[model samples]
Target: MTQTPRIDVVGGAYEEWCLRPAWHEVFGSAGRAASAIAAMAGPSKVTLHCYADARTAQVLEARCALEGTRLVAVAVPATCSFRYTHALQRPEVEVPQSTYASVVVRAETVLRFGMLEGDAVVHGKRVVYDPQGRLTPEPFGANGSSADELFIVLNEREALAITGLAEGATALKLAEATRALHKATGVIVKRGPLGALVLDGDDWTEVPAFETETVWKIGSGDVFAAHFALNWAAHGHSATDSAYRASLATAVYCDGRGFPEQSTLDVFPAMPIRASARWMAGRQPRIYLASPIFTLGQLWLVEQVRENLRMFGLEVFSPFHDVGYGSADDVVQLDLEGIHNSDLVYAVADGMDSGTIYEVGYARAQGKPVVVYCENESSEDLKMLEGSSCVLCKDYVSSIYRALWTAMAL
Candidate 1:
């Protein structure tokens, strides 16, 4: 009888806190990845190597026990933590350097920060070495170790940092540059929403990210790398196929904020997964912000929406920011022009402001997609919006993500 394969995951474990979406979890890259791998590995055994304090170690040990994952926690002075007001905002707390000494790896198939001797995947972290210091992208395999077969997964910024390529480099160019620098067998550059670019040997494949009704962006990349490692390194799947599966797994993680079960994986291929329209057009979509901005409270909400949308890397045309306060005749035409130029309209429908209602109606008339955040509004007030094919959401985070997805689909 054949023994089950053992997969090793070596990375950081820390505290993650968010405000708007209200999330508090005790998993950084290693913990999340190990959980995902264990969930999908079936009969395979999984081990996680990470640095953590006593409190974190205890929490991780309990979680591993529940998930049947082996925990190898190295004692640390303090477990690093990050706080975010929203998923798109930068972490308020600093991420201290966790790796003081080299972590020894003995497993044949490992997911790690750097290269291992056998089949391995590497993911670099953007962290600060000192408190109150700026974050820097840590290079992968900085100690010069190489693997028999290695895969490197990185975001666009990390790819540019590692390859020393100029900004705005094409995915294929970044992949080629990384291969030239590291001699990696495979390279995957993750483009959020736009999907991923995978290069194996001389072939290139584009993998589309599965759409989710709501997005929890934190740790989604870790889930992707974990799934990819499990499929490509442990199961010997092709790079492109592994990446496609990884995308599906990431969508499950983002929507549910938990590891996916085998049943979801079984049904994912049959589900409708459409590529983003922005991806096909090779340009970012513009969003027209329609909201009341007269009072202090209204202005604050409008600013919050605008900031969050911009943080998602979208081009926002906010009337308050762009046109400023003016008479109806002065601003109405320009506002309508902005709506005409945008790909979608995101309106805050609280209090049923007349201007916001008119803007939503006009956007619908022009056949542009509209997402309305209608908290505290009565059903009667939202009946027309619900009837006119507008996506209505009551919560803040869901409303924002719904608008983003709607724009991308357009």
Candidate 2:
């Protein structure tokens, strides 16, 4: 294994050294097929469509030229169904909240090359890279030419220490591999149930065949790949010894399951969960509990709102019946007043009540969070809150707490 062969790694260059290979080796069959995806790799542009005979539809015209792939927007239903709740209103001609939807699509041929955490094996070549802060493509050349390669340094000390954070491989496992293959020449192949293989240059030196006790495979390939890279790159290890070492490492990853990590642990952790409410402990939340002041449900919920906010130490504003319903002659002015008061609006859209619907519209018009709480599980009213910063509540108790937290953080 003199000069390493040139290979190109594709897919999102995510994780340390694209440890995905080690992940597959350790996790086997599971990691083999599923591809990794990230929203950070954004679409080229955004487009907005607000239907109104094209002239008055500012939503469409405003973004058509400016935002061409990822479109963030407010959707309005063709009409607001008044039957959904008490006094609910969705005028056939008026702007509906459901009419907005977000669509983000990558251009047909876009490739995102994140800083190389490690090398990627496309064919049977060893590709080197230098890490560059930039996230786009660059030409591959010698050390000085390659962008600062985030790709794993086959001979570097950190290789073994850098197992996937979420992947089950502990520092011990990584250390063991790193120490043994320090100056050796080999390729580690993480085989699913098949165990691992150590290949020197192109030849197999050992097969740490996995146990026959288990039935699943995952991350096994990743271990195999890492071992292979190390062994192949090690100074003096023969092609034969490299393969044997890779196989041995794969065996440990199998852990008698014959498959791999008992838990479906992957090279990468699952995506992080986003909170329903934007409220946080330090910052205050601008909340809009746009509900009827007269309804018992709305009133009962409002009292809890203050209590929940106290848990996180947050302040919120709710425009209840204070608008003085029949007393107000100008509905538009009354609605705008609520939006102008707060930074965000949380609508109680249960029953799709007209008053609640009006508040949601006002929130949208003001570009504020229109968080909604829906008491009934199955109601068209739920449709009214989709995509907006609104949370549709199914269970009042838990959702109430959740709403407060989410709103304040926003």
Candidate 3:
């Protein structure tokens, strides 16, 4: 008998869904996958889909590299079957039980460097174009309030996030229109208002939409896809249960912020319930990385800080710190929002950006901890943060540990 391939978790452009302040909670749906992949072995090959350009493509590459994983970017076919979506319009239970997802283990990379499934271990957790939020004057300072209170708020979005349905979807529109419908693992169809469905694998499970006053139904289906993929990858859950959980989570998320919810999954019994508990227990600290991008020094410094924060049981969010999104406006917006929400701010001073200096001042002004990673051996650059209390770490790891310890009053 062929040994079953143990999937760490499902990823790809799928994760970008969690980025929007509105849809992040739902699309950022599966924590288990992160945890599952984390617990695996060495570097692994992961295939990525749904990428926009070379920047994100390289980002995917860089992220995988940091995680001790290898990433292979593949074009996500424009036409995905409507079946791939969990329509999520129909009702499953008589009383609509709340849906939930279990956190799967994020073991260290299990697959060897050159040995991913089909020469790939894991793949895309990609995010397409999310043209929301702002272009800031002070890049990386958007969400820099403090790491202690790094929770996302619902920013009621205006645009809808929609993925193109499978090629034939525009044709038959019915999700089940598969060529060899019999050989495939069925489709997870996306339907507006009607909800989504999981057609194959096990029994068909109809997931209902969470009724809300209503806004835009843009990325609800993508949200459902995230949860379904998480459930499927983590638990090997039956199509029926996975679809149900994905549906409920999507509805709840869409109704509220349409973003990734930080709460541990709490709906159905995913295959690895303990995985959820472990991740929850880990409770990695949240780090809002703010810095000028493109320069190798800045990038390397940010990564080192992130690694240090992880050592201190913290989860970091520098989504914009990525060189791809590190455009001037992108960086500024990040500073604006990050300063508003972060428990502390870690500013890398390796590059030119008096604007970054402004953010440091902002963090200090707001009484949020500010840690500066100044590659230059000068105390002059640290002048901006003079009036406002802050820390100056010569190195990344020490600075991060110091910042966390300081945050904890240690």
Candidate 4:
């Protein structure tokens, strides 16, 4: 009988404060996420290597026991951040002062290289890479042990920072670069809402996200890394199979469940695997639809515009369609959030609603590309926007194409 692989999870442990209009809560980091993975792996032992303050260490110790996990906690100052977001709003995170990630990365090196031992180690920190975009294995001691599989799972932002790659760079390039620099058996790049990309040697696969009306997404990425490590390292499954299982596990967690059990496997369907879009020149662009929809007819028109843009493989964020006409403050806050998250702002300026005009200005102030659609207004009509290099379109169909094109440039 094959021995079950003992897993070590190396990462940051921080306190997250999530605030929305309706809810607010605090959560754990590697401890919570790794626990969920440990639960999924049944009897296999998972050792969490992370840093925390005294109080946080105590809390993590309890959480680990709740999920039958072991802790390799390092006592340090706990890192905390306040994230403000709504169901439809992108988060605005504020970090007061936290060297938590940097400190934890240093601690992770000591834990992995100097102390704890495991059959497989999963690393989850972008700080492991230096300014040169190379994984400095010398510091972490990534020895090529034939019996051990080292896996690294990083979100898109983290991957970009570590590899010194810009946004829209091919995921394959990120993965290949990391693999070449580190002694990683494989690298999994998490794309948040879209999906995850699995890279092993020359082969790469995209694991589609299991869509759900997510209640909380604070630790979904960590949960994904844990499950992938379990499947790929412990169970000896292929990278593609591991990523598929991890996606299902993530869906279960997003659906408000703590973790998944082997008996309930049928509840989560196996997500499809496809060729990664990382190499594609233009993956779908995220567009912020800045328009007025005070009336039902206007809302319908915005919906039509959204569908039209979607048909062109663009992700549209029509505040009116997404958040409805909520409170004045709520609408403003969420729309601003959407604009901040978007690649470009596409405004419908037919009537020049004050809110829509403000959104266009806000996008411009933030240095984002702005594309405006007006029925009769020429470039001369919106002189301020034109001076700001905003793209103007007279027709609706043409505006959508122009917005899509402008978004790609952004």
Candidate 5:
């Protein structure tokens, strides 16, 4: 464990094709994987096994050229699917192949054999056996895929996705189920923005998330996984300490400023542990102003609403102000991002804009508290909006206050 382990990471790598109303290219999971490994403290060699087209290969090659770690990129032509992210549009993703061709490379020869031995191996998808013929099928299940030492890290939603379990499943239940099935040494369930739950043997520990205003939530999970793996693999740290350090590093990544450095590990004493949303009431909550601002009158009202929220000591993300009638894709992206980061959504339904209606539904779907302020009370007959469990208000000023109060209570 003292020496840097030559890690073999098997995962998907593809180009993220997007049109923010204009074409823009970005690296998808492959770039994230490389970045995560480079963020580790020590120098290491990383062999990334992923499928890519020619364009994806060039992009990944240029990116890894400057990375601190020794990079061995093995890319082959494989079926790829396009993933798109735009505002107002539901993310579109084409179905990709379930599996890709895997190879083992040693010395100067690429081994066509199925197995390659390593000190440790990371498998993103389900695998039948490790290089040493160790059974390591993911989630192990009731089937026999035992490992000498196994750690299963998954968030609540991930647990549901993998097992097809219901949303109300407790972290302890998921952990215990996985352990009973797989006989894992430990299972860690991450609670978004709250903290993480670690179950090692019979001892359970909760590590509070480091206090940091989230600027970007995109790659926070990747950062956490990278830190945990590096700490556990290279430093031989305990499951508890590894999860704690991973949480700290993830806090830095969420800031959207830069990668977590070695010094970030030492900065915890000055920071506070994150509290629940209810405890965050004293702070100014960010509000996403969702409404149709097409006409001059609509724009004026939007501005007035924004000013009122600002005067009430709340941060506002107004699509009219932030994203004008620019790229259709960009507008959708900005508003969705704003909604994701906002504490609550204040949707002014004066004209009943379709986009606003969609935003209200979207916000509610994400479990964000939504306050629908309508000038007319006649529109309340719509059962869908009524059954949405949102707070309906007719008065403007009272609606703002009620929404703010509701957000703080949550």
Candidate 6:
């Protein structure tokens, strides 16, 4: 019998809460990655190294035991926790703070790196990571000195921080910049719905994201990193091929809000794999926000959608924010100009607002991609949109992701 490979995951484990979709889950980056690794490890061995409070440690211990993985959790005063109003919104610190001691675990073959804390600017307010959130002085080879391969998975923000690259850097640029740092053998930059960029040696590869009916954004990166490490380090696959498999795993996690089992991955539907030169060029699509803003609820929804789009580094033209309330002639011409200038239209069609509907139709006529978010609208009312090839989404998170993916394809 072949000796089983052992993978070590080093990162944070905390509590997560979402208000809009009403979700409560424990495990930050480390725990989530370990769960994903265990789900597909088969005969391989997986271990999680993290610092957590008593409650978090208990939860993680039980979860690891159930998944047939080993957990090496250091007891901390408290576990970091966050609460989010929406899946796309920045989370607020729910639990006070925790001090993490350095954890040293040797990986037999693969090691994955993730962050314990991160900084974010939410609604113009900057929320910095707590000083005590550091798990070690450096993560590169500290936790997996015995491993032959190391992979670092990060979002745009983390990559920027690591490489000291300025904001607005393209995925390829970020990957190349980080390559000089030499933190890992392979660096995978997760770009959410826009997919990921994998950097191995001097070459960069763009991995396309798969489509899913529902998207639960939380912990998706952990799933991607875990799967990528499994395919690349454990199975000896190429970096680009591993990243593609990771993208599929991410889609499964987002759609079901759970880690996919090995059997599910084996029978997963065949997906197209192609390089997108447009995305590689960093040509971000301009988006036109078409929605009714007369009522307070409608205005709130519009703001949420616009903010989420902007969060992804997208340029959005909102009539309410840009044009404001004005005479019909002035507003109509300006909105039309915005649509004409945009590459895609993201319309809120919950109430089938007339102006929004018109904008959608006009955008389609202008050969622009349109993603419509329709929750309560009847199918009869959306017949024209459906017939015209508008991408319709019924949920908030999925709608935002669909809009981003659709715009990226253009």
The local distance difference test score of each candidate is: 0.77, 0.36, 0.40, 0.62, 0.60, 0.74
TM-score for all models, in order of appearance: 0.86, 0.31, 0.30, 0.56, 0.58, 0.82
Estimate, for each residue in 1-410, the C-alpha lDDT of model 6 and write its tens digit: 65446777667788999976788888787788888888887533887777778889889978887888888777777767879887788788755454344565543554434445422111101100111233232434333243344455667777777667777788888776655454446677877655788888778888887777788888787788788777777677888998898889888888888788877777767453332578557676789999999999999988899889987667899999999998998799998999999989999996888889999999999889999988889999999999999999887888987877676666
Off by over 4 Å in 5: 1-3, 17-27, 72-74, 79-90, 95-99, 102-146, 264-410
Weakest ten-residue segment in model 4 by summed lDDT: 110-119
> For residues 1-410, what per-residue lDDT tens digits would candidate 2 score against the true structure?
25322222222111111221121111111111111101111123212111222222243334322322222222322311111111011112122444222222222111112122222212112321211222222222221222211222221123322332244353334334432433222323332222333333334432434332121123344344444334443222454454455445454444332322323333323222233233212346555556666778668766655455444445556554444455566555755675787766656655677767877876777777655656564655456467555655543433544554455345
Worst 10 residues of 1 by lDDT: 126-135
Error of 3 at 364 (Å): 51
Ordered from best to worst lDDT, the candidate numbers read 1, 6, 4, 5, 3, 2
C-alpha RMSD of candidate 1: 4.9
Two-way TM-score contest, 3 vs 6, winner: 6
Q: Compared with the true structure, what per-residue lDDT tens digits does model 3 show for residues 1-410?
A: 43222333332233332111222221211222332233222234222222213434544455555655434344432211111111111112111132122112233212111101111222222111111222111111122211110101011120111122333233122333331221234445443333444455344544544433222344544355445544554345665676676666655554443344434245422221112333334443455676765677567655666665664456666745433465677556655776777777777776547666777777777777777766464676566564466677664333554555444431
* Candidate 4 lDDT by residue in tens digits, 1-410: 66555666555555554433234333444565567666766544767776656766777778777767778765655444335432323355433253432323222221132111111232442212211112333322343222244555666666676667776677788877666655666777776445778887778998886544333555666567667766765676888998888888877876664677766567665443332343245566789988777787577668767876786568898886777766787777888899998888888886778888899999999999987877666656688888888887664544665665455444
- For model 5, the run of ten residues with the poorest summed lDDT: 108-117
The CA lDDT at 173 in model 3 is 29
Q: What CA RMSD would candidate 6 show?
A: 6.3
Whichever of 5 and 6 has more lDDT, that candidate is 6
Between candidates 2 and 5, name the one with more favorable lDDT. 5
lDDT of 5 by residue, 1-410 (tens): 35655544444454445443232443444346446657665444555555565766776676666665444545445434444432122346544444433433232101010121212233322121111112233444332233445666667665656555576688788767756655567777887544788888899988877654323444466567666766664456877898898888887775543676686657644253545465454467788999888888788778767886775457899888787777877678888888999989998887677899899899999998888777574754445677888778655544655665555445
Q: lDDT for model 1, on a 0 to 1 scale?
A: 0.77
Q: How well does candidate 3 score on lDDT at residue 221?
A: 43
Tell me the lDDT of model 1 at 69. Answer: 85
Question: Candidate 1, residues 1-410: lDDT per residue as tens digits?
Answer: 44436778887777889986788989877788889888888533788887778878989989999988888876767767879887776787644454355566566777874311111233322110000111133334544444677777877777777677898799999888876665578788887766899999999999987767667888888899888888888777899998888989998888878888779878654333454655466566899999988799899888889988886677899999999988989999999999999999999997999999999999999999999988789999899999999998876777887877676666
Q: Residue 150's C-alpha lDDT in candidate 4?
A: 51
